[model samples]
Target: MTVRKVLIFGRFERFWHWSQMVLIIVLMFSGFGLHGFHALLDFELAVALHTYAALALLVLWLFSVFWLFTTETWRHFLPTGRGLWQVLRFYTYGIFRGERHPYRKAFWRKHNPLQALAYLMLKVVLFPLIWITGLLYLFYFLWRDLPHASDLLFAVAVVHTGAAFAILAFVFIHVYMLTTGHSFAEHVAPMMTGFDEVELTPEEEAYLEKDQPAMIR
Candidate 1:
């Protein structure tokens, strides 16, 4: 019960969060336009936009991966089963009954079990699939004359589109989850302000007080 206002996200983490969203959103819009699902942009323009945004996102992902591992923040995405069922149950049944969220926020584990699992899938599965298929699709010009090249290109496009849809679905679900918290702002304030009400051990409190006093309030 020793909750304190602690710095859970650093400056670069906040940049990664917001910039990744913008890049993905741009990719989605231009992608759908390229798919002929919309007429908002010209085909050539859509291609340029999508390609540039994808490249930017790729660079961001590379730096983010490095930062996460170097900062030991990657542990936050390691899924655990201990509270997974309770968190799932709360979302499915208890939440509608006005039950408070079952998980506590720890500075080391900002994401709950289910949230961590989702993020793990996105980072390891969905994102890789999207980028791989996208690169293959984009560089098709080099392989245009290869055997069954047309077929390969179509297959790549299908897989790339499917992965994009999966990411779009994730965005919808993430936004919906934001509202499930005490308040929408409560869920969002931590990332924006870099401070969150999280439980701290006595040792952690003492360490922050002595080594990084500004990180705690």
Candidate 2:
């Protein structure tokens, strides 16, 4: 197999990823504090941090959506049946035996089938759930005069908190998957440097070389 350095991530994507991660961590801390899970900060301070972090995360999300559509990269997240079983086997059985990954990076596909499916669930389901519940909670005052506003607020809070926990669970699984790479840093290094070794077909190699040469190292 030929391994050559190819650009896989863009600068803006890198910025968005790390920024989102930090903001989520901040929200987690402040959120737990606000919910009386910890006394890391005063109530008012925790509320301020959580609110600001959520707002910042929302802005990042908007930019990411724009980036996804404008670049036509949303197709990358579309799930595929190909290689799902191999990837699952690799992680479950083959990895410990030191087998190569079942999926390859291509000009068109960067994520494996399972990863793509997870992203779909995150973007289509969890993110919207969290955003809607969170927004309703944040702007509760606008609907405070509704007949059962207090009851609705309680429901929104419960859903928002549940979604936060779901996100945290997803993060844990993602982090654990990082170690399943050839080396612990094999996956993460690409995000940091925006390039990684990929086995490119002749057509992809030729196209990147001719049209997007900067992507080939």
Candidate number of the best lDDT: 1
Best by TM-score, which number?
Answer: 1
Alpha carbon lDDT of each predicted model? 0.94, 0.89
Please report the TM-score between candidate 2 and the true structure. 0.95
lDDT (Cα, tens digit) per residue for candidate 1, span 119-183: 99999999999999999988898999999999999999899999999999999999989999679
Model 2, 1-217: lDDT tens digits are 3568998889998999899899989998899888889998999999899889888889999999999999999999998888999988988899889888888877678888999999899989988888888889899989999999999999998988998899999999998888886676877999999998888888878888899989998
TM-score of each: 0.97, 0.95
Ten-residue stretch with the least lDDT total in model 1 = 181-190
Inter-residue clash pairs, candidate 2: none
